[model samples]
Target: MENWEAGWDDGEVGESSFDYSNHTKSQFLDDVERRLKLFMVRCVKVCRTLPGSYDGQHFGQQLIRSSSSAAANFRAVRRGRSQKEYFAKLSVTIEELDESLFWLETLVSTDLMPEHRLADLIDEGYQLLKILSKSRKTASD
Candidate 1:
């Protein structure tokens, strides 16, 4: 079995306690990595749908850069050897996620993409912003 699944035999995921705080370190890391991957995929798909014009190309590249950084910087967060370092790297994810939301809003405003196309992604970015913000607050507290 994969590393994240290896601890299932220990009742790591019983129904009584199914929250993220209950997970092992590896499981948590894997969860973050999985989320980043999925977010990046969403970015790629949305960027590809942009119209073939100057604004489309500009926002597409901006979206790709921010979304990709959010995921890639997560790896850096995982590598952090100290609380300060971790928070520093994690902050990058927070900023990039927010930047992504801005770009998505821009696309919708310009009528370059339909609102339905970005609704889920917009919501996800908002959710992630809340999550990451809470995490950083907790870390420093």
Candidate 2:
């Protein structure tokens, strides 16, 4: 038997999976935007799996909005007309991402979903949040 127990999931994305050092600034921005889109897609997939209960519906709706809004605001950030606008859009993106993370944790805390199932998604959200937070700080300095 092929040791399924020891195998890693192909779909898994970890923090070290990406090496951004080799990418140019433009490419790095593109990759971040793409990652945000993928994050929204993943959030949608998880939301679809939620049971048709009040808590599930409530939190899932919140998650979908925050995740998608994060991605959209990030797109706006890329096209920002000025430094102030870019910073403002970036701030919104970070807020939405933070909200998404809150919803994900809520799902687990409310017993609507297990921690293992949302672990990867939650981790990715944190990574993105940290990146944006740092970017915002650097911009303000």
Candidate with the greatest TM-score versus the true structure: 2
- Per-model TM against the reference: 0.82, 0.87
Query: Model 2: per-residue lDDT, tens digit, 24-104?
Result: 667768878888999999999999999999889999999999999999999998898887998899899999999999999
Q: Give lDDT: candidate 2, residue 119.
A: 92
Task: Please report, in order, the local distance difference test score of every candidate based on alpha carbons.
Answer: 0.75, 0.82
How much is the lDDT of residue 5 in candidate 2?
Answer: 14
CA RMSD of all predictions: 6.7, 9.6
Worst 10 residues of 2 by lDDT: 1-10
Local distance difference test, candidate 2: 0.82
Residue range with the least summed lDDT across 10 consecutive positions in model 1: 1-10
TM-score of 2: 0.87
